[model samples]
Target: MDVLSYLATPFTDPLMLVAVALGTLAGVYVGAIPGLTGTMAVSLLVSLTFGWSTNVALAAMIGVYIGAVFGGSRSAILLNIPGAPAAVATGFDGYPLAQKGKAAQALGITTTMSCVGGIFGVLCLAFLTPLVSKISLNFSPVDYFLLGVMGLMMIGALGGGSMVKGLMGACVGVLLGRVGMDNMSGVVRFTFGSTSLMAGVPSVVAMIGLYGFSEALMQLKSRDFTVVKQDVKRIVPQFKEVVKHFWLTLRCSTIGMVVGALPGAGGTVAALLAYDHARRTTKNPEVPFGEGAIEGLVAPESSNNAAVGGAFIPMLTLGVPGDAITAIIMSALIVHGMQPGPLLMQNSKDLFYIVVSLCLIANILLLPFGLTGIRLFAKFVEIPKGRLFPIIVILAVTGAYVTNNLTIHIGWMLLFGFLGYLLKKFKYPASPLVLGIVLGNMLETNMRNGLVAFKGVGGFIGSIFTRPITFILFLVLFYFAVSRMRWWKAMMSKIKGFFKGLFTKKKA
Candidate 1:
């Protein structure tokens, strides 16, 4: 359906509009808060929405989905804290811009670009999903394996200053990922006989430590953050500047949507992949990518929002919950006496229509709410580091403790936090390690499953080579690895030459 057609259908529906507005507002607020996230917000709302009509529930859900993604930029730009994991890269550049007394302008730029990114994602969801879903259906074990490998390559890209540090970090993450019972043998790998370890280290706790606590410590070490009061003028983004990065924004949106559609992947992965993709594609990448790259802000915000739509594609059509949020939606469907999947589409067309309509409407409603909230949200940067760090530490502890309501998880978080601090000191990129931990079990189990399904190692390799998609993915990864190696050598050579030249000049 056309954009106008989509909106016109809902023009007379006051309740739908209300649901949309409320959802968007909730998303923005949930996303702007330091520890609150889009996933948590939607999950929390699932219970509340159970009694509402599908349209109402979905409108609120989708609205929060968009708002939370956008809300992440608030903390990212202002406090150097990403409201959501997707906004991690955004903080790198967004906070830097805020520090430069361009808080209002940065907020304006982020909100505007985020709006564009959201629209871009919505378009992809509306148009490309059918075609892409068909392609994804063809993904085999080898293709998935290659995809996992490529995803890990993001560590190299994200850990820009040091490959050694990045690889070490990734190794740590991989080792962490290897914890818990083996998928094939059912034998516990790294649990050390602890019942909690049997389930494995929670990625959320690791994420909290890696991004939250580690960041809190770093902030504590720095001198007090100078909160500059800037005139909050022209909160709207410059259309011309957005136009300049149109291609980049489009690419990021595509990345977000595609990554989001994947069954288990979420915004954090999409954001990281988009950030790496942007870094690889750009000629002169923004200097402070992790510290603050406007493009980083743009990529993840677009991708995560798009991912929401992408997740729905599978949930509505295939009966698969793509992520934690969709899982809740699936439960909501059960609670409402409507099953989600192919049958739901066929048997309950109106409900399906409402859900799809809500997603599109949520994207539409995001622009105004996001743009208007920029000024107030940007003020988050003004909070003293002293206040922010303690709060972060407390939240980190609470978030970790709440996992099992056990003090052990809190201890685990502290241990990881200390390790994170050490990794930071040594220039190791902790994210790749986290990704490895997250994906390791999947990689191992899937590989073993593929092997068993094929009946042997030879059969697995033969199947991989025979499958076009799998073969292509393998080749792509190979080429990327080689290219990265070459790039690393070139950078090392330049560094060596500069140092050598300086020594020679001194001797003369």
Candidate 2:
């Protein structure tokens, strides 16, 4: 009857404990493979568990949700392929570390940090749900628009030092994303009378082609077929390493939790925001970002896992779901004759706490399950190039097709793959392009909504200054935009040098 008893319920029941453990285990592998998203996995599990007891069904789904989120990092580290959209930022530095024979180290950190973030999120869910949920309800269209712009500005961080090229790549991606019918207006934009294009570009397929298929293509051009042995000697990470990045992990986890609590804004947005924050806040990472920076791994991994807990804040506290996965989960609760929201706490007290405890348990389970696969997962890099490229290409094709069961998607994959290869040849960053597509819809939709609410472009622009949240976001956006400029850096350098010279003369 007490909260402690409810929290301990899962651990007390052997059936529930085993269900959570097995679900976690299955989720890890499912999420590691491209095209098998957590949304799909959780949705499938929900249907199968419709006839099962409520407790076991809830435990199983919760475990899979946590495991899949963490599992996405596995592919990001090993193959430069992010198994889920949330892992997109993870692959930025993960694959680079893998190339340097540190895949094990990367995996270990992601696993441990995921646990830290997961627990932190669950704690927040337990104590701060009311406060967090209230804040989420206050987000206006202008605020969402600003959030999208903030995400887009990460192109500066992702551009590999070429802002112009990054902008160009992002613009191209925005066009690609526009191919589908407009969600608000319901009018087709660029389908060109082709029904297949009606669905627009699939982000997962794009990722598979850009990172996976294109990476394989780029490697083949080198004409080298030798397999390189990755060092698996130090698979387990050191405690000091975890301690060193704990501050960063905590900060990103905070970002994840807050962003996850917002409706329609999920871990993808949270992960990107955390990555940009890490880029700006981390003065001097041991390695530069996009080149195996440990901070890169710590930021996104921790934030995304933390988001899993944050997502529950709204789903349980209000009838509103935070993201697609949470929406499915809310529906599952409905199927069991349990409605979520304010009444959930008073009515289904045991069920609510059981979900919370399972999330905590699943994340803790991430450690052993995550680490055990390192030696085996690292072997991916050791496969001969001649053989590996074909496998990657095959997987990319399969994953792309499996997304919507449409052959045309495979054609789109090849086109994106070609585009990605050309971008690589030109030294342009493919990630900015991907980010453009990922944030394009959110940015466009919110901008349009804000415009309609304000009734004109002038009003929409004016609305930025009319509100506290928008003004703050505008200031942050301006800072990011200006700080990354070459002229700004040059001017700052000159000013600093002049001051240094003046100080030196005075000291003498």
Candidate 3:
């Protein structure tokens, strides 16, 4: 069949249309609940759909994937709890926006931006798959290491008020991340002889503890819970507001797509990087970040959804899984007797187009499904603190414990909850600590691999200059470091003053 026919399949077939819609609706609810991830839902569907026609199975799975990714931000906005790992950065600003009585607005913005990013990614998948896959392939260990370091540098921006305190929080996170056994040397680093510690602290546990449980504990101090009245009429954003953030949405979507294409570096990494990018690049946000910056909500939401589309490129064209969920999808394709490598397009070109068509349909459907219950979802923010805190604590503990089915994980959650509370009490930012935990292993693993590849520290450093991409990344890193320094800021100020004086003289 031709491309037009393939595209029309999902729209024309009644069963296919119903399947996609139902899958998307299921995905949204699954993703909105903490601990019930899209991966789990997709995996379960793979088994149930094993006997179905290829078109029907693919449509359902893609719909769920798209919806679940967008759904994660729902809980992040309503509660401080991230519904999925990718939504962790979303909670940073989303919850604060809820506090300001803009929960509905935040949800609306997220839905709109997510659709834009998803469509952008699908376009890239359709038109630029080969180029993007090639670029994804060229990312060396050194490049990844530099990327992690770049993410770490965002601690300065996320520090809120004190860079020193941010750095300290990051150090603590790094230490906690080191609790797992060493993957390279087979030596247990900080397990301290506990079998549970040998496996390391789960980041999800830490996330729920730090953000959800800690927030609950903090709220316990207050007896009154002021219900913020949400303006349902304002749920859908104005056209002017969309136009204002057009460039930011585009930029973050690009970041999401690129980051998503790299193997194993899924939406979580993409969202974090995009969040930092927005933080550093946006000249003036409408509100301060970590408080309720709309830019903050836009960047991560768009990027993570864009990553979903980017993730499919490598899987369809090269037989490589872009992320864990894509891996499952690829496996399902194999079980259906379709091979997924370079030959996939030659043999099963229709399948490729079908997947693309399903993704497009699903993303478009996401709007109505996502926006329908905004007022109902926003009501979660209005519950009394005395009543809500206990419920949050229960959810937090349950979410943390189910991660590994270990009580020790629950202990870790409580410990981190207390630590997060203390950090907040002392005016330290919790975000950088989470960032450190998320990137610490990636940073360490790549740095070690780069050292091994180059034979020594000096050689590893020199190798970055020899490669085109690595060299460019190094230059970007250098600029990032210098631009944040006091000297550079002062020099730029002087240059601006000199230009102003020159203009004044001309006027005189």
CA RMSD of all predictions: 6.2, 2.3, 1.9
Q: In model 2, what are the clashing residue pairs, if there are any?
A: none
Q: Which stretches of candidate 3 lie over 4 Å from their true place?
A: 497-508
Q: Candidate 1's C-alpha lDDT?
A: 0.72
Q: For candidate 3, give the lDDT.
A: 0.87
lDDT score at residue 286, model 2, on the 0-100 scale: 94
Q: Model 2: residues >4 Å from true position, as ranges?
A: 486-508
Q: Each model's TM-score, in the order given?
A: 0.86, 0.95, 0.95
- In the range 23-75, model 3's lDDT, one tens digit per residue, is 99888878887766788789989999999987889888998899899888998
Q: Candidate 1 has what TM-score? A: 0.86
Model 2 lDDT-worst window of ten: 222-231
How many residue pairs collide in each prediction? Answer: 10, 0, 0
Model 3's C-alpha root-mean-square deviation from the true structure amounts to 1.9
lDDT of 2 at 379: 92
lDDT accuracy of residue 405 in candidate 3: 83
What's the TM for model 3? 0.95
